[model samples]
Target: MIQLHDKIFKPFISSGELDETVSNMVQEVTKDLAGEIPVFVAILNGSFMFASDFLKKYPSNCEISFLKLASYEGTSSTLKVKQLVGLNTSLKNRTVVVLEDIVDTGNTIVEIADLLANEGAKDIKIASLFYKPEVYSKDLTIDYIGMSIPNKFIVGYGLDYDELGRNLPEVYQFYKQTDK
Candidate 1:
């Protein structure tokens, strides 16, 4: 169990499970991009750890980059994606894959796809580690998904609450707030 801000969140997804899931997803993604070497653009802050693990099992020749976007304040989605860091490479006629930590309202992924399209990327694929189907509102198709989780606040493995507890090895859920 992990304690955060007076609340205790039991382990929901262990590190081993996460690794196995990622490995499988990487295999699927590599198969999908078999003919082309795609440029993986990782959404920063949250997807950093997931991106690293995923690239290890990708089993293909690909380039990696990072794009930082922010859309959350605390544990709730603000429904707006703020692009803090921009893509430095020209994606014209290039196959690009956007790696994300979680997909909630789908605003961030949609925005990223649009941006890449505008920059002349030939194809765009989205690979998310976690997805919340209940609240997803975008019409875009996610090319790859690792897990579908309930609409609950989660932290750990690069996910955080109030910028704390992201370094935890496993994913945890916040059940409820405790009295301080």
Candidate 2:
């Protein structure tokens, strides 16, 4: 159990499990894009940790860039995605893979894919460490997914609550006490 700000959280996923999931995702990507020399665009702040682990285990040549987007104020999404930092690299005619920490309602990633497509990216792939299928409403397909989780507020392994709990080795979901 852990507390961040005014919320209590309970253990949801272990660090070992997460590592295995990431490794598997990387392996799958390598198999499909070994010699493609894809460009990996990591969504910043929240994706820092996942990007680090992902790039380290990726056994191929790839270009990397960061794009920071914000859609959450606290534990919930504001539903308005804002690009805090823009991508300087040219994605034109490139196979771009988007690295995200988590995909919930999918608004942010959808917007990113659309922008990359508009910029002339030959192909765009979405890879996320965590996914909330229950709440994901977008039509975009996630190329590689680490885990499919329920609609729960989780933090840790790059996810956070008001900028807290991102350093936690494992993942935790918000805990609500039942009044008995």
Candidate 3:
């Protein structure tokens, strides 16, 4: 168990399960991309682990890049995205894949997609490790998803609370405030 924001979160998804899910998702994405060599754009600060794992399972050729965006004020999102680190590569006419740790409100994904489009990316797709359907508000399509989870505060596998607990190998959920 781990503590965050005065809450205790028990382990939910184990490291093995995360690996399998990411592997399957990567395989699917590779099949979809087929002959095109897509650019894997990892959303930084949260997707480092997921992106690395996913890339290892990818059986196709691709390039990798990083972009940093911020939206969370704490456990809850502020629903506003701030571009902290911009994209350095030219996305014009390139096939771009945005890798994310989680998609809750979808605001961050939408903002990133729009930016990529404006920069002339020929195609844009999202590959997320987790999806919270209940709170997801954006109508934009998510091209690929690893898992759908219930509404809860989650950490680990690169997810964090106040910039902590990201080093855990498995995913955990905060069930009570006292645990933290």
Question: Candidate 2 — which residues are off by over 4 angstroms?
Answer: 177-180
Off by over 4 Å in 1: none
| Displacement of the residue 175 alpha carbon in candidate 1, Å | 1.4
Q: How do the residues 8-127 of candidate 2 rate in per-residue lDDT, one tens digit apiece?
A: 899999999989998999999999896799999999899988999999999999999999999999878999999899998999999999999999999999999988999899999999
Best by lDDT: 2
Tens digits of per-residue lDDT, candidate 1, 1-180, equal: 777876778788999989988998899988888989899999989988899999987887999889999999888889888999999888999999999999999999999999999989999999999999999988999989999999999999999988887898899998878777
Look at candidate 1 and tell me the lDDT of residue 98.
94
Q: What lDDT would candidate 2 get against the real structure? A: 0.93
What tens digits encode model 3's per-residue C-alpha lDDT throughout 125-168?
A: 99999999998988899989899999898999999988888999
Relative to the unseen true structure, what is the C-alpha lDDT of residue 124 in candidate 2, on a scale of 0 to 100? 98
lDDT of each model, Cα atoms only? 0.91, 0.93, 0.91
Q: How does candidate 1 fare on TM-score?
A: 0.96
- The order of the candidates by lDDT, greatest first, is 2, 3, 1
Write down the worst ten-residue block by lDDT for model 2.
Answer: 171-180
How large is the C-alpha RMSD of every model relative to the true structure? Answer: 1.1, 2.0, 1.3
